[model samples]
Target: MKQVVQNYKSGELAVLDVPVPGCKPGGVLVRTAYSLISTGTELMKVSEAGMSMLGKARSRPDQVAKVMQSVATNGMSATYRKVINQLDSYTPLGYSLCGVVEQVGPGIDDVAVGDLVACAGNEHALHAELNWVPKNLYARVPDGLAPQHAAFGTVGSIALQGVRRGEPQLGEVALVIGLGLIGQLVVQLLVASGARVIGVDPDPARCELAERLGAEACGDPASAAVENSVAEITGGLGVDQVYLAAGGGSNQPVELAARLSRDRGRVVDIGKCRLDLPWNAYYEKELDVRFSRSYGPGRYDPEYELEGRDYPIGYVRWTERRNLACFLDLLARDNVDVEPLVSHVADFGDAVKTYQRLKDGELKAVAVLFRYPEAVEEGEAEAPSVAVPAVRRGTSVPAPARSGRAPVRLAFVGAGNYATSMLLPHLAQRDGVELSTVVTTTALSATNAQRKFGFARATTDLDAVLGDPSVDAVFVVTRHSSHAELTRKALLAGKTVFVEKPLALTEEELAGVLAAVEESGNDRLQVGFNRRFAPLLQEARKQFGARTGPASLRYLVNAGRLQHGSWYLQQSTEGTRFAGEGGHFVDTASWLLDADPTSVYAVATPGNEDLQVVLDYPDGSTATLSYVTSGPSGFPKETLDLVADGRALRLDDFVRASVYGRKRWVSSRLPKARDKGQSAELAAFVKAVRTGGPMPVPLESLVATTAATLAVRTSLVSGAPVTLARGR
Candidate 1:
C-alpha cells in the first residue's frame, strides 16, 4: 500500500509503496478512503523529539537510568546501539479513517464484503490506500454518514471521551480549557449534553468556533475578569465543573479550575500538559478530580474492544466506538458542523508537511487530514539489504498433533536470538525431537549453533540440510526479511517447518510461503507464537473459559530487553519491537480468549517508558501490554491477570501464576524455573508435527499474532490505534 511515513532520521515525510498487510485472523482488510491528520499528536513525531542525545540524557534522567541498566545487563556495545539506532529510524502517522472492507480473514464475523466502516484505533487506521482493522474497532457506518465526516469520528470520540468522563449533568456549568481540535469538540459535546459551557483559548478564531458551538468564549484563562465572568454567568457560584482542554499552559488550568469550580465541583483533565495544582485550594473545596485516559475504563482493555465482548452496552452504550457513532450521529443530524474547524486538507504525500506546519506554527487549524491514494502502493526502501540474513528452527518431530512420533529427520536453518536464546535450548531437551543439522551464515555461528546445544551437524549452507534426504522438517529463525525466502525454499522441498514470529516481512511474502506450503501439500507449517504453550498462559486461558460473556485480561510485560540497538533497530528488518517481541504477548491473549479483535488504540506516553499498548478484543477481555523497562533486571519478563469467572487470576512471569480476591489478595506461583516456556513450546511444536490434526496454533492465529505486532508498529509510527479484523 502507498502510505506516508516520516523519516525520523531527517525529520522528513516520505510517501512510498508498502506491501499489502496479510489479513490476520479475526481481522478485516479495508481500502482506506479518508484518514485524518492529527496535528497535535503528529507534530513532535514528524520533527525530531526535540531532545539532543545529551539533552535527552539531561531531561530524561529516568530514561538515562534505564539505558544505564540496559548497558549493565546487555553490555556497552548493545546499549550504545540501542541508543543510536532509533534516533535514526523513520515513523508513520495517522490513526482514524473511513474505509471499505475488501477482504476478511479467518474467524471474522460482524464485518463482511462491502461493509463501510470507520477504523477505531491508530496504526491500523493509517493514511494509506488500505488498512487492516480488528473486529472490535471496526464500527459499521450508518448509511447517511459521509466517509470524510466519519473520518473525524475518532477525533470526535477522543474529544467526547473526555466529555463523557466529565459527566456533566443537566444545568451544570463547564469550562473547556483548551481550544484545539479535541478541545473544540469537547466544547461542542458539553453544550449538547445540556451543560452551560465556556471555552478558553488564546486564539480568537477557536473561541469563535466555540461560540458557534453554543459555548461562551473567553480570552486568557489567567486573566481575573474571566473568572468573574464565569462567576457572574453562574450566579456568583462559579462553574460546576472544569475540563482542562487548553494545553501548553502550566499550573494556570489547575489553579484556574480550582477558582472557577463551585463547591464539590468536578475537574476532568484530558490534555497533555504538566499540572501544578494548588492542593490546599482544591482540597478545601473538596473538588472531585478525575483524569480521563482516552475513552475511560473500557479504553485500554482487550475484552471490551477487540473480541466483540463489551461491558453491559446499557451502562456504557457509547464506548469509544459508540461515542464515534454518537458523534457521527450528531454530525449526520446536522447538530454540529466540523467543516469550519478543518483548516487544511492535503494529499497523503503532504502528510509530513502538514505536521511540519503544525510544529512550525505556519498553518493554523483545528483539524487536518491526509488523503491517501485510491490503491495500495509500496514506499522507498532504506538501503536495500545485500543479503537479509536467514533465520530458522526445526525438529525431527512431525505432525505430533495427529501422530505421536517424530518425523524421519530434523534440520534447522537460520539461527539468531530466538534460536540462540530460546528455541535451541528447548530443542536440546525435547524428547523425540532431534536437531540433526543446523545452518547459519557464518562458520562461527554454525559451529556455535551446533556445539552449544549439541546439534548433530552444522553448516553455512542452508541447502546442504534441505538437500539431505534424511531431513524432513526444518526450523527457521532468522530476521523477518529472510523468513519467507528460507521457508519457501524449505517447504517447496516438502519439509515441515516451525518459523518464528511474523511469518514474513509482508503479506506478499506470507502468501508466497503459504503457497509453497500448499504446493508441498504439507499442513505442518508452524510459526513460533510460543506463548500458546506457556503453562501459565494455558492456565489463564483454561480459567477464563470461553468468553460466553465479558472476559478481561491484564498483561504487564516488563519487556525490559531491546529498548533499542541490534537489527531490531531497523524497521525494515524486524519492523518494531511490537512486531518482534510484543507480538507474542498479544497473540497469546488472543489465542486464549479465541475472540476476534475489533479495534486497537494505543497511546505511547511521550519520552518512552517502553510502549504501553492496549488492545480491545471482541470477547470483552483487555490485553494491557505494559512494556516497562528500568528499575531492575531479571524482573520476570511478564505477569498476567485474567479477571473473570467472578475472580482475578494472576501469573507472575511463567514461573508463578495464581488467582486473587477474598477480602485479601492471594498469590499463586507456578512451580517452575524462569526459562520454563522453552521446553514446553518445543515439546508442543513436536507434538503438532507428529499429529497434524490442527497446528497447536492455527496458521490463522499465527498470522493474527504477527498482524497485532505490526498493528502496534502501525500505531507507533502513526501515533494512533490500529484496528484488527472483527469476526474470526
Candidate 2:
C-alpha cells in the first residue's frame, strides 16, 4: 500500500508504498475515513523547544546519562550507533481515527464487515490505511455521529474521563484552569452538567470562545476565585469545585485553588499542571484534592468490553462508548460547538503545515484537522489488495483440502527475551515440531534470533510462515497485546494456534477471537497458562481432581520484576499483571478446586497497587489470590499452597513442592527443568492437532478465567469489587 511517511533523514513528508496491515482474530482491519490531528499534543511532540535532539538531551538528562554510562561501560562506537539509529527513525503522526471495518477476525461477533468504528488505542491508530484494532479498544461509532466526531473519541474520552472525575454537582461552580483541547472539552461537559463554568486561558481567543459556549465568565486568571470578585457571583462563598486544566504551569493553580474554594470544596487536578502548595495553606483549606486519570473506571478493562462480554449495558451505561456519546450529545445539543471552536481544518495531506500553524499559535479553539486544503497534495491512489472472499463454514467445498502432514512444521511468532530466555531453549529439545521461523519486528532481530535459536532462517515477514503450506501450527509468544490478532490470523490461514496468557486486552477482543474460533470450526486452540504445566501445580491438580471435597490454592508471589516489562504499560500486551500473570493462578485455582470461579471479590489497600482477591465457587469451595505487582526486597517469584479434605500440597518455584497431610506426605522435587513449560505447551499444541485430545488448558475455560481477570482490573479501577460471572 502507498502510505504517508515522515522522513526524519530528509525532514520531508512523502507518500510511499508500505504493507497494509493484515486482519487478525478478535480484531478488524479498518480503512480510514478521517483522522483528527492533536494540535497541542503533536505540536509539542515534534516542535523546536521539544522533541529536537538538544531538547531531548536536556529534557531527559537521566536517559542521556544512561547512554553515556553505556558508552563508558560498553564502548563509544556502540553507543553512538544506537543513538544514531533512533535519530533516523521518523515518528508517526495521528492517534484518533474513524473508519470502516473491512475484515473481521475469528471469535469476534460484536462488529462485522462494513461496520463503522472508532479507533481508540495508539498502535491501532498507526494502521489507519488498514488498521487492526483489537476488539478491546475499538468502540462502535454511533449511527448519526460524523466520522470527524468519531475521530475525536479517544482524546475526547480522556477529557470526558477527567471531567467525570471532577465530580461536578449541579448548581456548583467549576473553575477550569487550562484552555487546551482537553481543557475546552472539560469546560463543555461541566457546563452540560449544569455547573456555572469559569474558563481560564492565557490566550484571548480561547477565553472568548469558551464564553460563546456558555461559560458564565472567562479570563486569563491570576487566581481561580477571588474572594470579593467571586463573592459577587457566589455571594462571598468560593467555588464549590476547581479543575486545574492548564499545561506546563506549576504551583500557580495550587495556590489559586486553595484560595478560591469554599470550605470542604473539591479540587480535581486533571492536567499536567504541577502542585507545590505550602503545607499550611493546603492543610488550612481542608479541600478534597484529587487527580483525574485517563477516562473513567473500567477504561482499560478486558472482561467487560472484549471477549464479547458486556458491562450490563445498564448501570455501566456508556463505558468508553458512553463517553463519546456524551461528547456527541453536547455537540448535538449545541452545548459545545466544535465547528466555530475549530480554528484549523487541514486535510490528511500537507501534514507539515499543521506543525507550522500550531507553533505560530494560529491554531486555536479545537485544533481538529491538521493537513491544509491547499498544501495537501493530490496523489494517485494505491492499488487495493484483492481480498479473499469470506468462506462460510458447513457449506460445500470445491474439492478435498490438502492432506495433513506427519510432523508439523512449526513457527513461533515472538522472540523477545522470554522466547530466548524461556520458550526457545525448551523447543530445541522437543519432538513432533520442527522450528522453521522466528518472526520479530525487524529483519536484524529476526536474524539474530534465528542464529541464536538454530532456526533455518528468520524474516520480519509473517507471511513467510502463513504462505508456507508446510507450516502446520504456530506458537505465539509475542507481547500480550498482539496475541489475539496474530492467533486469529494464523487460525484463518488454516493453522493451529497457541498463545500466552490473557487471550486479548478486553472482552471485545476475546469475543472477536471466539468468533474466529467458531469460524475455524477447529478445536485446535490453546492458551499458555504455564503454571498448569509446572510439575508441582499439575500434581496438585492431579491429587485434587480425584477427591470430592473442596480444594484451595494460593500463588504466594512477589511482583517487582513485572514492572520492568514495557508490554505491561501497554495493556493489550502484558494486560493488567493481575490478569496476565495472576489470572493464570486464578485459572489454576479453578482447576485445583475442580470448579469454575462463580464469584470474585477484590479489595485493595489505600495507596497500594496490590489487591487481595477471593474467588468463590459452588459447594462451599473458595480460593484466595494476592495480586501483588510490587514485592518485598529479595522475595521468591512464585509459590503455591493447595489443600483438599485431608491433604495439603506445597509447591515452590517449579522445583521443590510436595503434599504433606495425606498419601504418605510424599516429598519430591523437580531437578530444575528450566524450560519444561515451553516444551509441554508446544507438545500440547501439536497433540491437540494430531489426536484431538483434551487440551492442557481448554480455550473456553481459559477465556472464562481471562474474563474474571478483567473483572478484577475493573473492580480495582472503580474501587468497587466486581461480582463473579456464572456462564460467560
On TM-score, the candidate that comes out on top is 1
lDDT of 2 by residue, 311-345 (tens): 66667665665675566555544455454334444
Off by over 4 Å in 2: 1-406, 540-545, 561-565, 572-574, 606-608, 662-676, 690-694, 717-728
Q: What tens digits encode model 1's per-residue C-alpha lDDT throughout 61-102? A: 677899999999999999888877875665667778977899
How many clashes in each structure? Answer: 96, 27
Please give each candidate's TM-score.
Answer: 0.50, 0.48
Candidate 1's clash total is 96
Q: Please give the distance, in angstroms, between residue 289's alpha carbon in candidate 1 and its true position after superposition.
A: 1.4
Candidate 1 lDDT score relative to the true structure: 0.68
TM-score, cand. 2: 0.48
Task: Tell me the lDDT of model 2 at 540.
Answer: 54
Worst 10 residues of 1 by lDDT: 380-389
Worst 10 residues of 2 by lDDT: 379-388
